[model samples]
Target: MRLSSLLFCLCVASFPVMAAGQGLQRSGPMRFLYDMGVSDTDTSDPTMRQQLLQLREAGINVLSLDGWDAAAFQKLLPTLKADPLFSRFKYVLKIHPHVSSNWAANPTQVCSDAANGVLPADTAQLLDGVAAFGKQNADYVVGYYTFDEPSNKGVNNGTTICWQYQQLVYQRLRSGDPDSTDRPVITANTLYPVAPEDIKNSVSPNAQDIVFVDQYSTDPAVQATEYKDWGNMLKKVVPVFPAFSNNITTCQDPMLRTQFRPAVQSGLNTAYGANQPAVAGIAYFAFYPGRTYAYDAQNCAPIFNSVVDDLQHDPIPVMTKIEPSLNLILSCPASSSTAPASSSTSSEPCQ
Candidate 1:
């Protein structure tokens, strides 16, 4: 769709109240990491429980249940509510109409149908399910992740299909629960080198609530520049989460190969700019061993153990030390004299 037309759609749509710094303000400063490397249904497994404890001790406050849908999360919610270890951390839950990894080969059918003026029955049902799930679990569910790394390859005529698809998803989700201010729709896009305009066009308040920029470059300069650029570009449009790499292979310093200290530092520096926290929070790419390209082999028990051990001894401690400062910056309202111009309508400080 033409940029102007897309924006027109956004301007006309009836949206829910999106508080400033939505999730960050509501939940406090979040230290997010992805993938539990266990089945969502295995909430009671002794091994999973131990891992959950380890993550909590490591100062990770938010977990992403990426590959799970509303049904799977609903099934696991009981355990999350009952178990103190599980309940300690807030969660980012996934919903359906997901964009496929191999987008070129297998285009998202729903987006295509959407462009053709069709709302497939199954797709509507899935969105309804997500709305119901978000409403029921708002206490622990901080955000609803609907798309990951959507690209422009799936374009119809002049419009990006995924863009239209995301807008539809957002509308359906909001229509289901207009009063909700939490559980904003989220999308995790691929790393930088992508134009800020394109990023804004694809993921913005019009389509999704927040965009998690996944940047895993090992070079500190690249990390710093890309994150700073993202902060500058999206700060006025939508809140962003810097999803930095926690995989050891991406660590530049030999001394910190087993720690994510540098990654954490860079993310915080950019997100917590001198004037205000530009981004919402810092998110680690993957906590599970095989989730990243650096460690692609699945079911490697030894590697998993090594990763858990590294978290316990290294980066977690570093994060724990500075968490208080992080929360202060994240939760405190920006000074009236120093506050940057924001698109958010609410003037209330982030709690």
Candidate 2:
């Protein structure tokens, strides 16, 4: 744990990581990630385990642990960390204050100090947890999910609050690391409901480090239109951080063959064209095995597993190609959603 400038250059990944000097191109594979239920595979059941192993067999390498008992991680960590192929699997820890609830659980319910225009101590604890976990499991940990789509009602300077809180936790992460452990990456998959202005003014692309967005438009044509719109509006930071866009919950509206083909093709095209710092990948939301976040797959959306299967195949290799260099550039982005400029500062790895 040397506390100096550290730049790791990995040479063998399924995808070819773009050189820092090279701008975004139709580079390697996009990262294949599963926004799982903490233990996407069930904690108690081996079926999820089996599916994950199968995914690894198929070349999948990233998993976003949504919500589940954090305790479950202790048990699976060893197995996940042991597999050489899957060992370096990038993980996102979507944490909950009390467990089992997502940020969107109840907007009316108080979230954290940041939600109320103030910094809360609990935010530090959450960041600390992520940092501690990253240190314990270096190869498997990747990003920290600060908050999932926190803008249903719309708030002024929402990104500012988000940045401030993330910075606090990031400070703590570092403080604990007298050894300067690898900082966890931070990103909040903000819903489009929140204005880009909120994120723009709040995040310091370089300070916040890594970032992700959630744009779920089922209409391929409409979605493609929106991606171009985003590319135009966001500048400065995006081209530097990791950006993730998700599909709107499919259960809300079903996609037809016509709708699906264009949506998939155009959406990818638009993202690729955006030319952000690194469009590491794209992800869908409320992903589950048998059902959708709406809790109804057939109601309107495609089954969770089916969609993942399709998206998973194409991106795995692309990501593999870029893995070598990407693994290092994204190394220490303050996670827990902090922006590294604040009174609420600590050294906990925020990502």
Candidate 3:
């Protein structure tokens, strides 16, 4: 093994063994990006394997299976679990029932269906699949990504059903796993601004256990303020995971791209310094190449290569530097039905 790879393994070995359903309880902070963009077709590809190894060495400990449903994950997990390189990182699996659909194509229709309880059976089956998968692969799994940007303007339009949908998913997941101790439900909100009440209403103890807030702006000030604002706003309601923008579409300028590191650093500083709610971890908006918004459906080889290059140069070093100071504050205990008491302290460098 390479020196860095050896070091990473040794470091991972030193951390306490993670118990099922406690969420990611690493010694250092959980550092991950949005999606690996892996599909069933390329699960056995040699080049894709190498790229995953490179990402692990690049300081990302968490791997997100962004768009994969339960069946897709079931088929792919055995192959991934057997691979030494792929098995090294923890995963956040996507379990949303309508993951393959385009929410923007017809928000009203989608929202109406979700509101009217059109997919309860589908949702229950998906949750059961995930719960079974988690029991079988407890070590590799961390949480479930139940929805993405549910209240975005052009997406769910902050509909009451959209918010209720989150509650339904959360309730079902917990009903099966009892407190989601084995695997908590996670959701990501849009980067676009929303009202504070709407944001609060969208999240509840009965809904997502953890919430990822995405804000992409080239300016460090904008990144810092918005991320801190969102963190402060939702920290008490749910554990917050602040996502940084590595997506090139928004960060077109090369110099501005370099500013991402400080932007994330400053955001963490302000959020923790102000004594915000429990910040579970940090995440990048994505690792996929090309524009994330465009949903580029290209070959996996070139896309994986581009992602490897981007990681080797930019976000990896930022994560390497920032990760050390981020200590996991496990003082905030997990609750079965209610939100955990806010136990985050400003004394710790990062939480």
Q: Pick the candidate with the highest TM-score.
A: 3
Instruction: Give candidate 1 misplaced runs (Cα > 4 Å).
Output: 1-28, 37-41, 66-69, 96-118, 152-161, 191-205, 218-220, 224-277, 287-351
Q: CA RMSD for every model?
A: 12.4, 12.9, 12.4
lDDT of each: 0.45, 0.38, 0.45
Rank candidates, TM-score, best first: 3, 1, 2
Q: Estimate the TM-score for candidate 1.
A: 0.57
Instruction: Give the Cα-based TM-score of candidate 3 against the true structure.
Output: 0.60
For model 1, residues 1-351, the per-residue Cα lDDT tens digits are 101000000100122322333322222244455544223335565544554444344335555554435687677676666765555556666653343322223346665765675656656676777678867866566666666555332332332335666677777878885633356666655535555556555544466766665555545566667656555334312222222234533422122223343553455455544433333444444332323221122333333333334333322211212223222212232222211111112322124
For residues 182-263, what per-residue lDDT tens digits would candidate 3 score against the true structure? Answer: 3556766654466666666554445676666555554556655665546533531122222222443442222322444446
What's each prediction's TM-score?
A: 0.57, 0.54, 0.60
How many backbone clashes are present in model 3?
Answer: 2
Candidate 2 local lDDT, residue 189: 37
Residue 26 CA displacement from its true place in model 1, Å: 15
